[model samples]
Target: MKRILLVVLLGLISHFNFAQNPTGDWYGNLEVQPGVILPLVFHISEAEGIYSGTLDSPDQKAFDIPITNVTYTDTNLSIAITDMRLTYEGVVRSNALIEGTFKQSGLTIPLQLTREAVAIEAPNRPQEPQAPFPYTVQEITFDNKEANATFSGTITLPKVVFKGKKKLPAVILISGSGPQDRNEELLGHKPFLVIADYLTRNGIAVLRYDDRGTAASTGEFTGATSADFATDAQAAFDFLKTHPDIDASKIGFAGHSEGGLIAPMVAATNKEVAFIALLAGVGQPGDELLMDQGYLIGKAQGFDDEMLRKNRIAQEMMFTTVKEHYGDTEKIKEKLTIYLENALEQNPEMIPEGSSKEAMIKREINTLTSDWFQYLIITDPRPTLEKVTCPVLAINGSLDLQVPSQKNLTNIEESVKKGGNTDVTTVEFPNLNHLFQTTTTGSPSEYAILEETFSPDALKVLSEWIIEKTK
Candidate 1:
């Protein structure tokens, strides 16, 4: 009887080990909000007891997100990738149920997974039309030792009718803040496509691609800084000059938002660039801009001057603290933990009640703060503008709240003048928001609802300017 019992126990233990491996397909549903079900499918595997898989989000139309370093011990499972890390501490009962919480982006959200007998299929959607550029889109790849990765992008050009035809002028489109697709436009806007179409139609080639680590490109986007992005832009410019259809002498850059900053960096380095266009680019450093943004957001939400002042102080303190201890992460974290507690006790109203300090700190750190903010606060775009020997067109919308046009464009104009670049032109479109949408009131909320395509006026102005410059 004792021998039989031991055999049964060993069999049970082996079964449990096999069940917990988390290999094969696992289907789950995410509750983003009440009544909102986001279907998720994960293909999990184990390599030396580490969990690895790809996640597919049906609701987001996102698929094949590579997940690595996944591990499960008893009821607890955790996964970590380069930028995203998630831990699931829950039970797997009867070899089917996986109920737990998934921690990501500093917030812990509930997640449930179950082994499905049938395979889950994501909803099918029609593909977007290929770019209408006359020239074939070519893939360009380059290595950046600073970012420690190889970055790649697509270069679209005008079709060459014959050889020795004057080399076509080109522009490199830089994306804004966020994980932008190669086009740099989402939500049906397809701004890159629209811009590429227009520019290529006007005999100008354009290069636009997924910001490093997005789509087919390599590298970690979340961990990168503006200077890192500038390196990628430089690589793109270098690639363009080598193309047979491109005119090495007339190349320029047109960047939007953060991309705008990158444009100047490339132009500053490459004197061969003929011109540059700052399309709603930031003129000030990131930390200052963030403070301004917070204040504006507070004001828009009807916060009084005193409240705004207090919040600004808190933000500034946070920036200084983070910068001071950037390299010493352990000390920075310890100080931040203490500082956050004190901050909450002193100014409970600054952050929402019941919000986790850990979550806030996580959100505040990473590339956005550590790298981008640090670079922005220190490096003045004006130096790049001054270094630029090419003509420049800086456009901003009067209603843009993200990078307030009044201050940014004014700074640009002043900087260009100081740099002695007389060819610089600045334009502000009234009632247009950061995305260049003309609206009754320029607000971010309006962007989701309005889809008029790239502002025709803006496109016309851009095309005309390019034509005149290339001519």
Candidate 2:
């Protein structure tokens, strides 16, 4: 449950009379959240008086994103990536400086562009394996007939194949949330790639794929719920069962974040699933998990008690309304609208500085009633875990704010045990954030800055556990 940031854009200086050559590279830092900063670079070029450019978010490992529109007149400059619904409007303050506002979704943040490049050192991910490796890697695709979706992925087979012994045990790596590629790449780190490499090197086969409607996979991701993603994971499991190199009896799921939720859902009814390793998986109801997520992250980020209280009130009301009127879009919207109207009446500060109260209410209602939001807010994972009889390993970072360790881990073990399944193991790694990276405050703002991709101790724990289970 990622926290949403909404704030009004501040005023910018007036346009100057002199025109600055907006060519070459322009750099800036985007204050995406309160404490998170994403460094952006715009590579602009002029062709016969027509300007075109590309944007790069280096921290996110994104590069060469097309800038569909660019207009430079006098001292005013504007650029838009229509596909991303991202726009930047600025006034050239000098030959080397431009003050602007970066707007995406419904939130606006101030951004300043400058000619001097910001020094962003590449993150050091020692765990990420290089090519020409010891394992056999293959690019592949599997189809989900139910979803009518084709998933593109990489399958790594250990070099040490069993001649007369048992077949290779395999696990499908599932990503958390968002439009993730096969690597589960984020913040310049490829956790899946590293995991696949380590496990394959340790003689366990690994299959990691892009989510449906993400990257090379074919399907619509938007409006799809966790249930839909479970079908996709099931499709992956089915594919591995028929593969020549994989042992059908030893196949399992290793999911991170939301993927953790999907793993239990798949294993609940599918007795064939060998085991499941949940990484920062949620054990509580979706609504409760989200409320805790908001509160924990807010507190970690130093949000005032009053602000946190209001946010909790807003989230609680919205989630409760959605759950009560589950599927009744009109009723949910009406209830949320009224609730927000009352909230804003009591706390005028809830309204964004430059936004109208009605507009804010409408936006909040629309988000809370959205298809994915509704599904996430209403789903509970404990019941699914209770039905799962397979071996379960639920692990989390003690400092993780996204899915706090103690609450979720306890629920996971108890739920599985309550169903008469005793093959459950849970561990809480201290000082680690959501991604398993050792951190100070465990704030997401620290994710990109810190270089250690996936913690080596975590990798060792995961690989050793899988080996023991498979053996």
Candidate 3:
């Protein structure tokens, strides 16, 4: 995700016009990589004496993404997108130019803006559906009674049902981590939306919703752990089963990434679920998975195996120390600090440049104490998989660096089979990333630039698997 910006050229400039407000389309291009340039447009406007704006990343196919806040003085501009962890700072140098730096993910790159006459065209996603009359999309709210939260979402069903059909098979989509909206929108791709559209068009019912405290959902999002998220899936499962047009026994879970880990958690206890689809799910203990995830992604970014090994070892020790002193934050902090200090003393190079050993230790402590990471760091997904007696379909892409295809799929398959689950199928699609997008390299930086949002081939395989198993 390294985006080092270098100016290739500049747009035409115009005469000064200071009295005019900066309420117009300001455009800039971000060189995300060496060859890929992502164009960004900020539509700044004022309403009720407050500044507001929407951002467009044309190359990423993301248009009109809401900017949380945009405040500017007569000569300076400040814009922010809290959810995306992005911020922009600029000063109006002239009528045609606004000099700025785009900050995201700890990188600063020059992103001076130029007034654009024509709008920056967002890339077309041919597969994204245009409304007409194909499926029945119903607004919904399911009660997560266990957690005292209400989830808002949409349920898409095929408009045409067979004459003799008593109940329609259904699938509930669980998002990966973080607070995601119903569409699981990220990196300019709405994978869940594409999946729901394709599945409903093919006669499958799909339920997808916002995470707790996200969008229209109600609850505290950041304070919840993966275990708490499992209950959210269970709640959705219960609600889907109650639908008059749904076959209670045929309702299943289709979880992606961290969501995949949540699927077995729901299925293990909810016997009503008929099947499950695991997309790039965790197949090992969370600590090991984290290590592998970082290592693979680092290697993809040009890190040598020796460097990765050193970092891996260092992290392993920290994770081990944290786990050993579980539930005791004070001891965990003390031990982790000592562990980090020793590691640094042995090799000062281990500490990141411009950062101290103490700061890194504090950051590690905070991470290990978080509700989400603490639970998942040592979690073993197999234990839950063993309890899920329903039919299972686990699939991963060969090029997925986050969840390496071989070990994850193989271990998941083995764990389920050992639990006497003969109704299981596992597959790894060639050359696709964790998001199921076709790419040259599985680096996540390419996700935004790649035109293919979700591979039709992979979606077809998954949709077919779900339909078959549910039937």
The candidate, 1 or 3, that scores higher on TM-score is: 3
Candidate 1: clashing residue pairs, number: 3
Query: What is the lDDT of every predicted structure here?
Result: 0.72, 0.87, 0.83
> What lDDT score goes with residue 36 in model 1?
40
lDDT tens digits, residue span 1-471, model 1 = 999999999999878866654577777876544434457787878777666788886544467887745667775666554334444455565467777776653456787788873343332212223545356777877666666667667777677532455778888888987678777655435677778777776677888877778777778876577887888888777777888877788788889988888888887777888888988987886678888878876676567999899889877887777667655656666776677678777775655433355545555554334555555655667777777778888898887878888899988877777877788888898888888878765655455456554676888788889778876
Model 3 over residues 243-311: C-alpha lDDT tens digits? 998888888889999999999998888788889999998889999999999998988878777879999
Q: Candidates' TM-scores?
A: 0.71, 0.83, 0.80
Off by over 4 Å in 3: 1-30, 34-108, 113-120, 342-359
Task: Arrange candidates, best TM-score first.
Answer: 2, 3, 1
Candidate 1 positional error at 467, Å? 1.7
Q: What is the lDDT of candidate 2?
A: 0.87
- Count of backbone clashes for each model? 3, 0, 0
Worst 10 residues of 2 by lDDT: 4-13
Q: Candidate 1, 46: how far from true, in Å?
A: 16
Candidate 1, residue 213: Cα displacement in angstroms equals: 2.2
Candidate 2 residue-wise lDDT, 171-236, digit = tens: 999899877899999977898999999999998999999998888999988888889999999999
